[model samples]
Target: MTGLLAFTVLVALVGLERVAELVVSVRNAAWSKARGGIESGQGHFPFMVVLHTGLLVGALVEAWVRRPDVAPVLAWSMLALVLASQALRWWCIASLGRRWNTRVIVVPGLPPVVSGPYRLVRHPNYVAVVVEGVALPLVHAAWTTALVFTVLNAGLLAVRIRAEDAALETLPRSTEVEHA
Candidate 1:
């Protein structure tokens, strides 16, 4: 099979993984709502969805239309990063469990999660997101998609993180110390 074909399969797999995430997010959102969760950043949610969907579509379109010659070394390395991002994303989901939602919904009085990947970074999932945003498109030499996604995602994340931080402030402070 051609490299483009392989990359297409990879993108399709990632898209399917996204569908699974939505399933989990919906269920978890219900769980959080049951516990008096308050959602913030609703205004940017539609943009977020469109941007993410565009990532996949743009990558594929660029790969097909541009038909750039894929460098094996870059392809392999980026593929590794893409896989690592997916692993990190799932680790975040596991760490947050039912507390995790695509939307910024925080339950009142519940302490912020400081376990798993959260111990390392306040928003490890976004770390995964940033990495994947660049790496996945590069897997098939779709540099334009990667660049555009990164720029747009950066602006979106700025708004998103601020809203999330504000919402999280509603939660009680954890007494547990974070170890360096």
Candidate 2:
């Protein structure tokens, strides 16, 4: 029963973290709108929601319901990745400021953000995501979750990255900014 309670609390915390992300997205949208940014990818929004939601459910089911004990080394390693993911996520948020949205919103005249995490990699957030997708499940020895989401996210990322690049290219900021 204690294990169950602990597991439930963890799930709730994860959900809350997602809610916090949504709040950031909302704030970002307001800023983008004020800047006359044109947001696209309406069609992709729902799919992203579904996929992220599934990840939560999948992790709970694999980790809690199934109650698999992960290898100590693997769990520690994944925990490290999860911690790194949090750091990177915040880095992206801070670097992008109000320009970052859950959806693609391109503000004209605002050069594509190229600082902090972006300076190191064009898509550091995605890197965090890919790492977390595998790490979260692996922390509990949920190989099934790791394998499935990794593959699915990979495909989704291809489309997502292309769309984001195309959107960024049109922003006025791109005129003088070079893609790193």
Candidate 3:
């Protein structure tokens, strides 16, 4: 298969992985709601959904329509970053377990989780998100998508992270630094 075809397949696989994440998010959301979890950032949820979906669609469209030349070194390096981002994302889900969802929900009285990737950074998932945003498109030389997504996502994340921090604040603080 040609490089473009392979990149398409890769993007399709990532899309499928996104579906899997939604499945988990839905289940976890229900679980959280059952426990009286308060959700913040609802206002931005729709935009987040559109932007993330657009990431996949935009990357594929640019790759096919623009037919950008994919250098082997760049493609391989970006592919590695994409895979690493996925791994980090899943690690976050595993660490948070039922506490993890696409929406920002915090269970009152519960202490912030400081384990796994959270130990290293306050929002490791977002780190994964930023890396994937740039790396995935550049894997196929979809620079426009990469640039657009990064800019839009940065604005979205600024709102999202603030909302998340505010929601997490409802939980009781622990002696350890809060990184959930």
Tell me the TM-score of model 3: 0.96
- Cα-based RMSD of the predictions, in order? 2.8, 3.3, 2.2
lDDT of each residue in 24-105, candidate 2, tens digit only: 9998898888879788767777888888788878887877767876567986787788778878888888778777778889
- Model 1 spans with C-alpha error above 4 angstroms: 175-180
Q: Which structure is stronger by TM-score: 1 or 3? A: 1
Q: Which candidate number maximizes TM-score? A: 1
Candidate 2 clashes: the total is 0
lDDT of 1 at 151: 100
Relative to the unseen true structure, what is the C-alpha lDDT of residue 22 in candidate 2, on a scale of 0 to 100? 93
lDDT accuracy of residue 96 in candidate 2: 81
Residue pairs clashing in model 3 are none
Task: Score each candidate by Cα lDDT.
Answer: 0.94, 0.78, 0.93
Q: How close to the true structure is residue 131 of candidate 2, measured as C-alpha lDDT?
A: 90
TM-score of each: 0.97, 0.89, 0.96
Ten-residue region with minimum lDDT total, candidate 1: 171-180
